[model samples]
Target: MQRVVSNLCNLLCSHYEITLISCYKANETLPATYNFPTNVKIIYFNEIYPDFKLDSFWDKVKFSYRINQLLPNGSKNILIVNNLLYPFFKKKNTIYIRLFHNSFENAYKKYLYKKPLFPPRIALFDKLIVLSSKELNHWQKLHKNIEVIPNFLPSIPKESSPLQSKIVLSVGRMDKGDQKGFFRLVDIWEIVQKDSRFGEWKLHIVGDGLLKEQIEEKIKAKNLQDSIILKPFTNQIEQEYLQASIYAMTSLFEGLPMVLVESASFGLPQISFDINTGPSDIIENEKSGFLIPDGDLEGYAEKLKALMQNQNLRESMGKRAKEIAQEKFSKEAILLKWQKMFNN
Candidate 1:
């Protein structure tokens, strides 16, 4: 979300008077991880509520108060907030557009025990902006006004991978055991390795999280210490794509997975579970990549093995990936959509 905000503001700052309100301190010692244009103003509200936790509604109220103080009246301002909605979000004349970061069905599927609220809390905003059309259709069933504006690629590479390396790339934080599906990816890699032909291949996962130690233990248990490597989150993620021949993701769901789009920019053939929202939007099923059925472990391995064995097939699919990235996920294309939204 930080990357998204930074990139969006960088693009908008060229045309709009942009102010970036953040939750963390932005001082000499602690600055933003991503660079912001000089025109974009920065605000750090963390000090206002020194010790914060999501234990109660009053805690959310304090958080909202900080937000309100930064841009109290929304009369001429368009408040694009993803942080949290209200204990106090009602601002007169403000065009509130809440960014729903996850697929509509993603959280519900993960937490089946918790029934979803009718209409969902996103209805609190004047407009709800989602990343994919899949989720757009889902919420349209409720007759809520929504927009499908996918993520824009942060940068497009001048050179794509040659598809000659024996490495597979997967990038995302392992927030929990399942959200990004690194656990299932480990399970999938184990199956892919059953064929001795894949002996020299490597799986490079780049990201760090609360579950990092547990994922490390799982790799050791499988004796995949050498074959499967876990890399820390990187600022230069393009380097990972350049070093690999293919990309794969086992995510159960997504609101347009940026990694998949990033892979497309590097012209890497991808293999991913056809979850509720993301993969189908970017991949042309067998053209740019393969979209395996959810939980079809064997099917995923079979398709990945096919790509690993044939260089021609990987190159063909990768070429299509680059084309798709340019035509659909370009920054200029998405910025126009946002411009229209902001104008009227």
Candidate 2:
């Protein structure tokens, strides 16, 4: 969503002087040449040195002071916050929009306060932007200004080559084994490999993880390296989607992944383990993609193998996936929604 937000802000700047602020320290770095347009000014909030991990009252006091110091200098600035440094620094003219990526009521009630990184001031924004109707409804009961604007997709590439292989791809950080269902996917793959139903179709795992070495060990022990390809993370993810015929997701949960939107942009039909809150909103079951019951290992394999055996089914669903993404999640569509909200 960073790229989408950046691009949308740039588009908005044709009519307004927009400054993009980054509050969190980079979890990882991007190449410097990955540039935004020249008109856009990028500023990180670390100049005031907010204490990232507050272990004591002193740290919280210092952090609050630092945030007050770092609050932008203009009275009229539209402070679009991703649920950080909110309610701490109030400006009468500042239009604070809470971009709630996750932490819907279920997630908030279950995990927010327990996690060190959960934003404590989530309730103080002028308005909240969520991804789904379910989340908007959940927040609207407590807060009045909640809106649902789903994640945006970039324009589709002009040319898409025909699928050359029966490759099923799963993309995510492999670090949280259960979160992305990497371990469960591997276990299901193990069962599918031994069965005659899968034949020579391959499962390609993309993206890096903390469990890389352990996952490699498991693959080696199973003697399935020949049938499975494990790739490190890459910015050039479109290449994988272009080459593969299907996108497979086994996420136990999500905040509506941009990858699913991007996969649909590539016209790749998906086979996902439908857990709470994301896939059903995006997939539309067998129409655009196939969704298995939450964590149903047998169902995951059965559906994956079924799609693998039928090339016609893959093409039919993939076309539908692309169409849905183009209509609902395109960048222009989302920006128009934002434009109306900001102007109103």
Each candidate's number of clashing pairs is 0, 0
Worst 10 residues of 2 by lDDT: 27-36
lDDT of 2 by residue, 1-344 (tens): 56656656656777777777665547445314444667877766664455465666566556545655545675566667663344555655667777767747545755455864444455566788888776765677557887788877657665452555878888998775457878778888887898866758788999787887778888888887887789989988888889898888988788887788788888888888776677777797998889898868998888888777888888888888888888888877877887788787
Q: Name the regions of candidate 2 deviating beyond 4 angstroms.
A: 1-5, 24-34, 48-76, 103-107, 111-120
Q: Which candidate's lDDT is highest? A: 1
* Per-candidate TM-score against the hidden true structure: 0.85, 0.85
Give me the runs in candidate 1 sitting further than 4 Å from their true place: 23-32, 45-75, 87-93, 108-121, 141-143
| Cα error, candidate 2, residue 203 (Å) | 0.6
- Residues 35-81, model 1: lDDT tens digits: 77778887766665668565777877676666666674535778888
> What is the alpha-carbon lDDT of model 2 when measured against the actual structure?
0.74
Please list the Cα RMSD from the true structure of every candidate, rounded to 1 decimal place: 3.4, 3.5
**CA lDDT of each prediction against the hidden true structure:** 0.83, 0.74
